[model samples]
Target: MTRRPYRDLVIFARGGGWGVDRAADGYDPVAVIRGTDFAAVRSGRTETVPRRWEKRTLIVPRRVRPGDVLLEISGGSVARGQTTGRSLFVGPDVLPAFELPVIPASFCRLVRFDTTLVDPRYAYYGLLDMYLSGRAGDYENQSTGISNFQFERFLDAELLRVPPMAEQRRIAGVLAALDDKIEINERVVTATEELLRAEFDALAVTGHGSVPVTELVEFNPRTPPPERAGAPYVDMAALPTHVAGIRSWSHRPPRGGSRFRNGDTLLARITPCLENGKTGYVDFLAPGQTATGSTEFIVLRARPGVPPQFPYFLARDERFRGHAVRKMAGSSGRQRVNAADAADFRISVPSPERLAVFGERAGAAFTHMAGLLAESRALQSLRDALLPELMAGRRIRPAPAPAVTGAATDDAGSSVYAQ
Candidate 1:
């Protein structure tokens, strides 16, 4: 093992580009992963990654590959204590999520390690440790309210402890195993939700009757405030665009916000959020518990006799979303859809018997998804706890030979080796 300057192990490092919006004469479309998308992309959620056209010449050089790392070079919120040096490791499992060729966005840079000197996965863990330890913040420069990572300075000043190749692979393998499980869980949850959507679409085509949505769902229904001083509070940002589950929340004093109980759907009422498909199902709260959230939420709850999960699928329905979008009023950017307008929109309702059957299936799927999410959280906690100790060469000692497989493969059978 030896300590060396961080730059010594890097074979390539360059900032990314934001190509034109349209595919011009010499441009090809590519998926651009931005700093904001690091978490989603890492979790195998690629729907939010934007597509942009870039010159083939530029694309060839910036194209992302398995084993590379995407480093955020700009943009962070001081108030949130977020630094600009966060990174995402592009493992074999993450590449298939993109339909087009992938590249980091302008505010990010692609980093590739020298395989002979350090394992890319091991290098990534080192970078992650730096960020998690807040050491990355030491190299940040603030200007005009935006934080920028001083990449050159970081490379010159930081030192990394590199072990033998076999040891590097062993350490990386242990961490990757945890990540692989989390990724698999996410994929399963995504597939389950997609299946539910398909079932909902099928039912929509053969419903018993048509009626105003208000008859089935009560929008923004009034509810009594929680008695607890600090109740679970979900802000607008906690709402997910493509998934039904809300993964994050905080405890705060309830002070005049939309209040909802479990089994309710929270839809973003504001322009960009609504248009971007920001919605969530309230299933994280304890049984009979009520939570408060952003006033920008329009809570949708099923009426008696309706399926409890109906409002969530309805909120995600294309036709229902289009109606809500068309009903937007107020100023341009701040436009919002009225709760009454959304409630008045009509939809075909399945017979009570059929509804009950659909509910049984969808409810089971959601329960399974919730369980998977809980497991992922636990795995994440375990990974976080082990990361620092392993990186510091404590607790687990390096093996004489690699204790795991030489390469990690994704569901598509594509493989990424330690190199």
Candidate 2:
């Protein structure tokens, strides 16, 4: 393997900047991938990516294409130890999933690899390896509260191992196979949540009586905080919008935040977070365990006769969300909905028998989703562990085996074989 400066192997272009304007003449609507959307996009969830309008003159130059990597060069939290330089690879398959032309937002830069010198996917993996290994932090410069990536310095300072083209493709194929499987699992999770929401909506319409939401669910339910030190802690950022399961959490001393058991639903109460649909079901903890999270969370737990999954789906309901938004109090960006106000939200209650049936159906779907999430976590761990070694050429593996019955393939039509 030969090492070369990162700057020599790729071209960098700034992303676009323009407010969304649907009726603007001579403007084209394009989906803009922001830094906040990195996690979801990486996990194959693109529904949350925002659409903005850009001048037609600027569209062609900033337009994203397959094989390009969108690198976050700005806006990261210094307090959270999340440095800039997160990257997302746009593969051929990812483009078709978007309804509008996609481009990186103003905070990101488009990294285009010179195909003659290196493979794009391989280059992306190299960048990912750098970030995961914490090497990218070396090039981070923080001012005020926002952390920005010193892209030029990083490109000039860091060196990447250039493997042979065949070897590059082979390595990318193996890693992409794992990613593909994880993505497929994400799709199933999304589909399952959608199905549960549909069923819940149907039940809500056909059910007998109307009652206050407090009748079926307890808001900010009182639960003893975790007794032990370093309990699982979920921040507002960990909550997912469309997904039922929380993707990440940390172990920290319980310091007086909203505490809940495994069956509660955590909903973001603050302005942008609430508006962004940040709600997550609490099922990742061990049996009988309690966890604490950000004070901004309003925990929703089902009452005696109600199903555990009911509160989560209800929190996801459009009308319920609208009511919560309307109930928001406080000044400007800090506005939040109080638990008391949210508890006042009303819903139609179904019969006990019907509730039980819906519980069983929703519970099964949630169980399957949990299993899929577990599998994805395992796959992600494997990929993270293998990334550094593979990119550094420390681990030399054989080329992927030829496609057999039902084996997956990459965008280039090459067979994918897991290591």
Candidate 3:
């Protein structure tokens, strides 16, 4: 509430430290979220994310309130609205790993701008731009990461050019509009998926007969051949999202891993990540390339008559995950599920007729969801592009977008500013 041209922002570490886990594909929030509590996050998105703990150097906000901006001074680059991904906190008396220092609340500084000086949303966009451009220029990195990465503290100290609040609002308006649309699209996809899955379960009848999923389908060996020297390792990072696909591949070449083939289903056999439904179906594995993944995922192939989508659907089911959780063993702190259990797990395979019917319905839902997912991703990209430009003085004329004018701001051209 200060009219001061410059305000102070404080960042600190609090709560406890977070634990990292191996997600199916990319890593999930092991350190940031509810410390491996996938069950809680799955049940409650916002609450689970916000209340989750991680004892990092918590960036405590100076005077943060609802609707105020929260910038992760440390996380290098972020999409416009998506920057506010998850809560940054730890439980009582906990601390981050001593090796990985977190952003202490003291490290943050608030930019106190008069409402007339700079709209906070607009400032956020500027911050995003600075973050990205800095990365591109390599200004944020200190020599190949062998050196310290101190962009967060540096940015906090760097000065920002504050424009009139009205202008900030206008610039923010356009960017926000795209973000709002993207958010809406994401919700639609999630709602539709949830509804379809719920309906499928309701229609599905429980038959007691059981068979190992491995037997019901064909299995492939994707393990990279024994590493001679510079060969790639089959780490989990190679797996893709949603359906079975490999987006990226690499050969670390240390361990003697096997290889995977096309149409093979990658079932994650690790805790936390396995619980998070980290499964991917390989559409194709380059000949002799031998795709690799973490010993975490159990790779398999569905036999003829089984839809490619069928494996994906079953792998994502909660029941399958529960079986995965039960099969896990090892240290309590970091449970490791074995590949053997995944290769020979019992599943409630419906009759062929039921499998066909359910597959048909699930297929429709997957198609619809896929479209929504693509669209949402596009909208998000656009929104991200405009965020920094509008926020920083990189683009746009000054002027707070006229507060959504039509009795209901969203419908009006200026709706982007709707509180």
Candidate 4:
């Protein structure tokens, strides 16, 4: 093993992508992967696909290649979990798992590794160790107004410690085991949610009834949050931008965010955040208890007898999200959806008997999804706990057998674009 400059191992790297508004008529739904998408994938939440782009848009000249890793270079992406200056491997094993032709957006750099000099998988894991292990600060340059990672400087000066190919495979294998299970768990949650949506759509097709979202959901519901000592606070980061669940919450004064009780749906009202899919169901709190989150959230709770999870999937609707995005009003960057407009969203409602049945079935599915999320979280903790030690040539435990058989392979046949 020897330490070397990263530039010696990389063949080419650059950033380019057409604006979503600039996408013209074409059959290809060439997806421009932004910093948010990169962060979601890095967190093993690959199911959060951005629907901000037109699927019929033309493919741009800048596209992903096998072995190309998209690294977020600009913005506070590091704090957002994009891991500034880190490489997100887009190898054949990883790309096929996604739905569309995911090209790196303007804020990201596409780095195609020189496979002859470096094993792509190994290089990816090493970068993960560096970035996720909090070693990214040494390689990042946030001095400019924007947080632009100085990849060139890192390539020129940073010492990249590379192990032999055999060792790299072993290390990647061990880490991939934990990641594989996490990915599988994510797939299960995604599939189950899709099925529930399909069932909801079926109910709509049966001519059950149509009603304004307000009839079934209360917008901006009020709550008297507790003090910091006992309050459970959920920030925007605690909510997943793409996935269907909240990642974490804390006991902080519920002083600033919108308030809501259990079974409420929190949909981000701000620009880019709403467009990125930051909506979640509130089940972490007890029935009588309440929680607070970013003021940018619009809380929606089901009316009596309505399925608690129904509003969550309703907010997840493509048409509903489109309407919310269109109704956003304010400056270009600070736009937010008006709660009244959100309440005006129309959706189908099944007959009481049918709705009750759907509620029972959907509740079971959601409960199972939560279980999977919990399992994945625990597995992620184990992996994160072991990542640094394994990367540093120090083994905490005997390396397990390779987990690549199911790793990076999407067995569920989920669409590239989330449903």
Would you list the clashing residue pairs of candidate 4?
Answer: 99-416
Lowest lDDT block of 10, candidate 3: 84-93
- In order of appearance, the predictions have TM-scores of 0.90, 0.91, 0.59, 0.80
lDDT, residue 67, model 4? 70
Instruction: Provide the lDDT at 303 for model 4.
Output: 84
lDDT of each: 0.84, 0.83, 0.47, 0.71
Clashes of 4: 1
Model 1, runs deviating above 4 Å: 205-209, 396-419
- Pick the winner on lDDT between candidates 3 and 4: 4
Task: Tell me the tens digit of each residue's lDDT in model 1 across 1-419.
Answer: 48787889888997899999987998999999999898788778898899999889898789999999999989987866788888999988788878899989999999999999999999999998898889999999988889999999999887788988887887787778777877777788988998889988888832433677888899999787886778899988789988898988889887878999999999999999999999999888887788999989999999998888999998998888888999989987899998998876777878888889999998998998988887677666656766787777765433232111223222112212222
Q: Lowest summed lDDT over 10 consecutive residues: which window, candidate 4? A: 410-419
Which digits, one per residue and each the tens of the lDDT, describe model 2 over residues 1-419? 59999889986566656556574988888988987887677667788888889888887888889999999988877667777888989988777879988888988988888999999999999889888888889998877767788988988898988978998898898788777877888888988888888989988732443777788899998897697667899998788878889989999888889999888999999998998999999999999899999999999999997889999988888888988999999998899999999887667878889899999999999998998888778767767766776776764444443231123333223322224
Candidate 3 CA-lDDT value: 0.47
Whose lDDT is greatest here? 1
Off by over 4 Å in 3: 1-44, 50-64, 73-116, 134-156, 203-209, 218-265, 280-295, 329-335, 387-419
User: Which prediction has more favorable lDDT, 1 or 4?
Assistant: 1
